[model samples]
Target: MNITVCNPLLRTPLSLIVDDSCPVINLTYYWIHQRHAWKARHQPNIAPERWEGDTIQLKKIPPTIPADFAWEWAEWCWENGVKGKFSLIPYPAGIGRVDEGFPDFPTREYQAWLRIYRELIWPSFDLTPEMLTHTAVVDLDTFTLTEAWEQVEWVDPPVDNRLTDYIIIAMEMLDNVGIPCEGVTSPGAFGKRQEAAYARAVLTASQHVNNNPRPFYFLWLKHDELPDVPIWYPDKEKGVAIASIVSCAGDWFGGWTGYDLGDADRFITEDLQGGCLPPILEKELPCVLVGHWPGFYFNGEKSGFEILKTVKARLDAYDPDGTKTLWMKNSEIGHYWMARELTKLTVMEEPPQIHLSTQFPTANFTLALDTPVRHIQVNGWDLREVHSRRDFQTDTFLVEGKQTFVAFDLEVGKTELELIVA
Candidate 1:
């Protein structure tokens, strides 16, 4: 009698192809410039003399304690393959106008702060105007703002150009300060309108300022009943394509509940592994986590900084070679994911080549193989020795190699590739 044994290794596909969804640290600036305002409101007696002169001098004002916290957090991101989206709210509260309580633009003090941002903060992170003052629209002349309740109402299916105007203003401010304002993230809440004016405003601003379309990374909570996918606003006439990505985690600051170093570990082992990875792997979506600077520095001890470092360590351990996990700033990830969605992918079995044609030629994609790859060719040209990882499954009867992972870039137009298995 003749018996045959099935090879589990043979049953697996020669290569596993999937899109990469990188993790992002979405840090918001709510109180970066609000300390004076908070003091005036709570302890009026000790507040700094209200600056009545047109020229406010902030050069003498030392960096806020929170600025150090921010620097420390950014340092960890730089060291560890982590990227961040820092929301820059130019005016906090009591720093700008007397009545309306907005910072005066072009003031010497304001310029000093901008210089600090350009020199110190801008290098490590991508900046977003978290909406001027992060509150209601203010009248420069009257020194009054729109109703507080109606401030962020533009988010509710914005139909008018109010949000667009705000975005343009914010972009102009960043440009004046020499900060590249590539995207926008809404403050917090919105109303019930279905038109999606906020997203349209972001795209319009990007085209007007940067002369290109860009994606918006919105603050999304886990409990929010929204799909974790790129949201595209359909406008075929002008050929505007923009997407909104929902954040995967709640605010790192104890918004729902304070998260510490241990919480950071749980976020990776439980929440990220169980909640984010499944959807990303199954649906090919980006997994972005959002947090606020105030939340992380709630205790003034830089706990959030530690949490960020711990999260990076966990991610590094999960993918030591850094081939499987893609770490990028939120804006970069948004643009890349949008490009991947728009691109067309085709795989050939005979030559074992993957073909990608995309408007975005520089987008990155990963290819996983069951057998060791000898070499890879792109567009019929030989690529330099590519990095790959080997996996193995052991059993009592046999120890078989599982898969090898490879990452490559796809250029615009037809990109032909060939993979030789060793």
Candidate 2:
């Protein structure tokens, strides 16, 4: 007697077979505190240092000021395939005496620095308001600021209107300074309630201030479990979502305390292979590495910077053809991840078109097509095709037998795209 058995497995979903050829690497430089960095590096003797029995806390400080060094670093990023997000604060940590009036911008020196940032650095890096003052609480009513040690962490279950007011003030100040603040980095940790409250306030304020309701991403460094992908902090009441990108690496500046490039290398590799690649292979999430401004430079040399370059070189060697690795700014990574999370794609065979819709219609998204594309018409208009093999800046990539990838802006309503396959 013969017996036959039926199998239950079926074909894999197209969505599950997302293109894994493009892997993203994002860098976030935290505690940028540019003014403070300059002061600390230039006048180390006068700069505040935490004194212990055997050692002073500040270590491996830069020899000269950081302006030129920062400019050089930006230029290097432009030349190399690196992009990052910078945490910016209007006032340095210890800007004035405890009783001094709240710090304001357009200082002659800082204005000049802002010009440099706008012209040179802004293109390669996205800026986040690291808070108005890195460590002080400014009384909005009296315009008085308190010392760093005197202030406490912005409350976990934040004061009713204080967090909102603080966020708006920071955004407005960055705006006035001509810096586009797309996201924010919390100065310290927040509890679940605090995170939710903060998310609600950011959503409400961003909509009113910018007139564009884009998702705001909050970069938080410390996490007990390493995040496999960007975690979503959704405020259900407010209908807003904040993507929290985890830092897989230690503060590289902390290397001065004992950690070295080997530690950095291990962390970078873990983030690339353990943290980022697995998600990209399965869920299409990007990997973001966090560092500090001081960490990259030490005693007139690029300490963390050199380590990063070495890692990039290793990554390039690992993927020689450059099909599987992408260097992206923090904002770009956030945009793509947000778009992917919100997007819905439907293929209609009746009219032979692909329909794409998203909760965030105004956001931009990248589509990696497995099939050969002869033409693409977006919203009934044929998209202009530019055939170029430029490195670093090229938007299109080739995969599996001349597959086409295109980045397009999604509209609020249904976006119809006609793809004529070759």
lDDT of 2: 0.49
Pairs that clash in candidate 1 = 96-102, 96-103, 97-102, 156-191, 157-193, 253-295
51-157, model 2: which lDDT tens digit per residue?
11012322333222345566676677768756666656554343522122224422443444555567766676666665555555677677566433112346463
Best by TM-score: 2
lDDT of each: 0.48, 0.49
Residue-wise C-alpha lDDT for candidate 1, range 26-111, written one tens digit per residue: 12122223434544565678744432111133322222333344455555555654655666654433244211223323344334
> Residue 6 error for model 2, in Å?
32
Per-residue lDDT for 219 in model 2? 38
Task: Give the Å error, residue 132, model 1.
Answer: 1.3
TM-score of each: 0.66, 0.69
Model 1, position 319, has a per-residue lDDT of: 55
Worst 10 residues of 2 by lDDT: 16-25
Clashing pairs in 2: none
